[model samples]
Target: MSDRKPINDAMDHMNGIEGYPTNVDLKSLPKPLRYFGYFFISFFVLFFITFFVLSMIL
Candidate 1:
């Protein structure tokens, strides 16, 4: 029974998707890539403010 248990457990976890990764390790990315989240938020806020101010002036 022990021999079949491992095989059955693996089958149950399978989602049947093809050519896609099952997991990701973000820590493997470089330092700059990890800090992209902060830069993205800052850029979004700055763009929104600039657009709002321009519209108000016009």
Candidate 2:
């Protein structure tokens, strides 16, 4: 039973598509500004959600 389990798991992984995009493509932006751009966008989204919730509660 244990030996059959390993073969089943290996086959499952091999059956899927490989080499997919798993991270952000930072090189498309200017080097020094990429971090700031990501940070600014994330902060704006978080701030908007917080403000929206506060407004609804008050």
* RMSD, one per candidate, in order: 7.4, 8.1
Clashing pairs in 2: none
Clashes per candidate (backbone, < 3 Å): 0, 0
Question: RMSD to the native, candidate 1?
Answer: 7.4
Model 1 lDDT per residue over 1-58, tens place: 1223324645645633332343568787788987897799899999999999999999
Task: Give the TM-score of each candidate.
Answer: 0.44, 0.46
Candidate 2 local distance difference test against the native: 0.71
- Tell me the tens digit of each residue's lDDT in model 2 across 1-58: 1223325765646644352344557687786698898889999999999999999999
In TM-score terms, candidate 1 sits at 0.44
lDDT of each: 0.69, 0.71
TM-score of 2: 0.46
Q: Which stretches of candidate 2 lie over 4 Å from their true place?
A: 1-26
